[model samples]
Target: MLFLDDSKAAHLFFNRLMESLPDHVYFKDREGRFLCVNRAHALYLGLRSPSEAVGRTDYDFFEPAQAKQKDADEREILRSGVGFIEKEERANSIKGVERWVMTTKLPLFGDDGEMIGTFGISRNISEMKQAREALNAHHRLLSTLIDILPCRIVVKDREGRIKLTNRTYRTALGLAEEDSVLGRKLSELSSDGRTQRYAEDDRAVLEQGASILNREDYDASPLGDKRWLLLSKVPLRDASGRVEGVVGMAADITAQKESEARAVEAQRALEEKNRQIESELQIARELQTELMASSMQSVQAELAAGSPFLPRLAFHYEPSAHLAGDFFQFVPVSQKSFALVMCDVMGHGVKAALVTTLVRGLVANIRVDDTSPAQTLHALNERLCALLDRPPLPRFVTAVHALFDTEAGVVRMASAGHPWPLLEREGEGAAPVSELECGPALGLIRGAVYRDIEFSVARGDRLLVFTDGWTEEADDDGEEFGIQRLAEALRRCRAENPYTTLDDLATALRGHAPGRTLADDVCAVLAAF
Candidate 1:
């Protein structure tokens, strides 16, 4: 900066002043020939020293195209007598390496108020160029990744204009490129309802600097196709804590919504099926009840006056479920003879109750007038085997058939694999009558036969025929209320009517099996003579 104008020291000082500066410094004549150069400028041109670059024109060192451009700039500056400051230039150096330079050129004077040449200084900015290029490359990569994302992404300015859009967003609108949609208002692409909603959301994020997250939307196209979307918006902020704009993203949730709708439909179908099943069960229960009532009425009647038989007939019936396997009836053969038949099918439910009906039909077909107890049972058994063996799964029934001959004062009784009937005489104790196991249970063996035994009966003697469901009941302690307990119960009911004796038996079984539900159907036919 030492300037002693019009002195030899001034020329010498100026010559050596900028030699050590790292920037390229040189003075060139109007013809673009180098008049002087610093050591740094000589090194940049790949010269041994300033002496190598001095007096050389630009064409001698630079490419022809670059030399022509520079010659044009120098002539322009010389004609206008103006200077260029901080201009950026890009070119290959004398060493053949491309670089950028920040350059300043000014008109040089001869100290006589006349322009002599151009004074220039250039600073190599290659490192800055490399950094800026790297930043640009990263921005391009980020933009590519955003465009390829599966979710629809878009950016809107503070005025709700579409500033940017990704590939998915444009494709959703059936557009091939975002160029046609960018810088347009949202109302141009969607309905008023959608645009108003978008405007509200944009205001929240861009103006209020808020975030709208996980907002769901529903839409239907003209074809009646429905869709679901999840959207989120956040404010883009500058370093000064000011809102720059808003960034919005939306994800399609149509599949998830459809799956939920299908699940709801399946649940509704299941509920309807359950209702159908319940209705069928109720119908079955009502039909079974009607059948049982009809069975009772067919056998229920008071004997005529002046007859030898009892004046009162009583019975007890209870089913473990809606349908029962146990059934009984009274058949009046003649004025002086009658039969009480009680049967127990193997299991309880619609299947077993169906078997009981079959047993009833077979018993009604028997010729009880001329046949004995054994012969009547034999006829019922053969018919049941024929009917039951026809089904895929077989079933069986155990029964007791008792015929009272009032005129002869004797009882002819037989059994088919069933528990013995109880007889309580006026003077004797109650006991299960011993009879031979003459035949297998009905429906188990074809052509099975039964046997009868006759015993004298007094005028006031009581008879009880019942199914095994009464004797085999169990208490919480797992002990059975066996036939012995039933016999004892019958003995206690000797003073009451025949019907009261059956009730006492049921009450005794419940006492023994306290707090227990009925495990099987119970039935009894009681008569006094």
Candidate 2:
């Protein structure tokens, strides 16, 4: 090696070693100025040489706003003299290209143990993130949302003890709200024929991955009450496909069962009152609207006021002539989380609207805080399929369920034969993030499974969740306003104020249709988080 001064030799020795490493190495002074950089760091920052990056700050190599956070992180390390073991961060290069990096920073001290600067190493993990994204796209698992569902959902372990239960199940069993009556086996609920039957079905599910669909049974409660239950049970499997537990869902049909026995005698009276039923239907429609509007008023008001829990909210719903088969609502999962629910029952008119009514009632009751979107949709599917089978109507329902965590800035979404949502980020420079998967419509096939995908949503990001009516509405020329136009419209509005997002979409959608009246029901919600 060439001869040099002690300090210069020390610098040279460290530089040579660090430069040989593939990861970026950097040194920052207490004031956040770059003291030294390795070859990898220089290349990453687009510097001609390590010397060229000396004394420069991250602002010189990144956007000023982005640099502020990095500066804060380094300053905090210097002030606290504590090391950041490993922090994975998302960032953009000087060229404004986005990537992921795993960074480690430690306090640099002199021989006397006096803190001098910060020594950091950052490894580009963009390739790893890309591979993970691809894998998530193909093989996504929607875990259990069974806990927060409004229905009487129960999960039994291999030993037949209850592993989990939803609120509805506890209430139905006459348990107190604060009671955690877990490990209660099916046989413990009652010593009747129904419990014996359920035990056999649970065994079948665990042994053979069997699925029992819409099996009606009488629940003889220990409280000395009898109720009709439409129960469905399915096997739970591990990654290796080994059956581990069995999940059971129940729908109460006590009222319907009671009404059926009176239907025959009331048929003659109903025949005489057929002409007056139209007025009654109108009253029912008005009542439904009033109920929905009342239920959603508080949340809508809070979101409009720019509450911390709900940054922004906008919605538009248009029901086609003859009936209202479209329904959408917001359910609060907790103090800081909420769910946007959108559903459309197929084949318009009284029957379809009635189905929507049923769907809305179930949604209003479900607690989404402890559930996954996939689990929520599965519970809905099981209930709707069983309920609709009573008359076997010529219709199905499509829906999208999304849970938003305000504090953490995360979104979990699942769809039931619904269209994928459109996303618009904060700034114009940010491109729209869209596309995932849409599962089958509910009530179509027995025991159909749906999956969920999760993504990070920023504070100012806007999500457009709509029904097919919004995208499939045809113009006078018979051309539908497709996804491309919708995306372009969302992009165009990204530069505008967040408050203008819903109006922009509504106007754009209406203009595309070229008529005062829509041919189909349309339900849309624009949520800014």
How well is each residue in 1-529 modelled by candidate 2, as lDDT tens digits? 2122368778687757877989988887788888888888788888778888877888888877779989888888887888896688877877877778999999988677899888899899999989988887654332235445656887888999887777677777777542456787867765555577668889888888879999887754434478887889999888998888998888888888889868966987788687578678777767756655554565555443333436566566566754678777777666567777788888766877878778888876676667898889988888878777765574689998888777677888899998878777767433333365678898877788888888887767778887888778889888998887887887777634544765787689889866557778777777766
Instruction: Quote the lDDT for 515 in model 2.
Output: 58
User: Which candidate number maximizes lDDT?
Assistant: 1
Tens-place lDDT per residue, model 1, 1-529, is 2232858887777776767688988888877778888888787788888878777888887888887888888888899999899888886855696888888988877768788888799899989989989999998998999998988888887787888989888777766878898998767876545567678878878767879899877872211236687888999777998898889888889898889899999999999997996687667766655655554455444333465554356777888876788887677776666777788888887788778777878887887767988888888888888888866433788888887666677778888888887877887877877745546888888888788988876777777778888888888777788888888887777655666677777888899888889888888867677
lDDT against true structure, model 2: 0.76
* Position 128, candidate 2: lDDT: 95
Give residue 271's error in model 2 in angstroms. Answer: 19
Q: Name the regions of candidate 1 deviating beyond 4 angstroms.
A: 1-224, 227-304, 309-311, 392-394, 427-429, 476-478, 492-497, 512-516
